[model samples]
Target: MAYRGRFAPSPSGPLHAGSLVAALASWLDARAHGGAWLVRIEDVDRPRNVPGADEEILRQLAACGLVPDRPPTWQSQREALYQAALDRLVREGKAYPCACSRRDIALALFAQGRERTRHGELVYPGTCRAGLHGQEARAWRLRVPEGVVPWTDRRVGVHLQNVAEEVGDFVLKRADGLFAYQLAVVVDDADQGITHVVRGEDLVDNTPRQILLQRALGVPTPQYLHAPLVLGPNGEKLSKQNGAAAVEVAQPAAALAAAARVLGITVDPRVAVPELLAQAVRAWGARYP
Candidate 1:
């Protein structure tokens, strides 16, 4: 575990400015720590994946002088790995079949007049945790036990979440049969021996669920640093779903500079991409180390 890190991005769209910030931060931190930096395309959910988005993302990352140590891996091609993990969870009784649809959960909450939980999203009321109520199992869910998952983030400070109470037994495999991100990411990180995760703060909540999955799967949890997100003009997190504009790949240094600024690193505009990245990496090492 020689400071291995990764930047896993979904292939829903091209790299937007916000996503570039996440990329740069992950890359810089790896370089700063003298670690192996890897890239993984999270395209397991094929329905939402945009055609050509994966190639374009790789091209964009290279343009910004952020190259993966090895050819990037794709989640879609790693089905067997995910299936093995899911099967293990099932065999151990740590996970169970779930048949409740979104509407069923929503209606159940509405019946109880409970719209949202404190952590948001219709807190699944464990409707199918027992036995799917005589219906066919449509998905699989992790049996989150009651406890507090506490961890100190390198950047965001301490975070504690009661996964059982806040999120209830969460889905491991979706009703559509796609493995959930929580399971896929945990399995991938452990398999890759990832020791550090540097990404945007928007993913802060996802950490606890991932940590729980790692514990159940007997995998090591990585150090995390949730950096500040790049917000849109409207103050919303710039996201592909939010219609955030793509980064200007024609000007690699400019895009890198913008992302560096978001990470609080100052760069010389006159420098070329390589020099710019070298300077930024040094700055990141000083700041984070």
Candidate 2:
């Protein structure tokens, strides 16, 4: 497959240090393997997007000398592919309609003393799977097999999750027709022919759901690597909404070099972009540590 890899960033805001860490890791891994590095703006959830944020993200990457092999791809332009994947899941009985709402599911779980849903969304009871529809509209959920989500992670060790038991049936396409991240990511990865996925650790739990979707649609799954979460000075994760500042695109070499240091690499911040990339490639090869 020639080791094709992708850096998919959501356009919620400008690139933050956390985002830069993810991008740097994926870029180094792809380059070290002599693979193609690609970019995809995951603007599927349009509500959170900032106008012009996508362009700003690309500009920041360019400043960091992390140019993708091909022109950048956008998720908003790929509705048909997502639809096809959804249709296949339904036809194969791998997914079904769910009518549970946030409140209803929460109440169901409160009765059981469970504090949170496995995916952090309310744990869905099998309320809609039996052809029973509530008063509200229905969203589609994957009929996750009653077993563990078996897989391995490059960063996290020995990954497993029983989606049926832990996460419950997860939504595929929301009632408003916006595809779930699980569905969209699987479709896009297959569509782009991604052979390896090196991203942040926050997505490690979501990997199982994605793997299920991939198997249901008969898409070849990519190798997975989840990096550590970037924490704030308060010990919380850094996020755009949490006031994490944008990666200084005006000084991208500095941003890239800083991210490398944060990831425990001993490279100098003043290294040129090209040489920094080469050093990064060598560092990544020593161990994904």
lDDT of each candidate versus the true structure: 0.91, 0.85
Q: Write the per-residue lDDT of candidate 1 for residues 159-255, one digit (tens) a residue.
A: 9998887888898889888988888999999999999999999999999999989999999999999988988778888899889988898999888
Best-matching candidate per lDDT: 1
* Candidate 1: residue 17 Cα off by (Å): 0.5
Lowest-lDDT window of 10 residues in candidate 1? 113-122
Taking all chains together, each candidate's TM-score versus the true structure is 0.97, 0.94
For model 2, how does the per-residue alpha-carbon lDDT over 1-289 read when each residue is reduced to its tens digit? 7899999999999899999999999998898888999999999998889999999999888899899999999999998988888887788777887777788788878888876755457767777777654455568888877888789887667888887877888898987779888888999999999999999888887998888878888889899998877899888889998899988877766787788886677676676888877887889878763
Superposed Cα deviation of residue 61, candidate 1 (Å): 0.9
Sequence-dependent TM-score of model 1: 0.97
Clash counts per candidate, in order, are 0, 0
Best candidate, TM-score-wise?
1
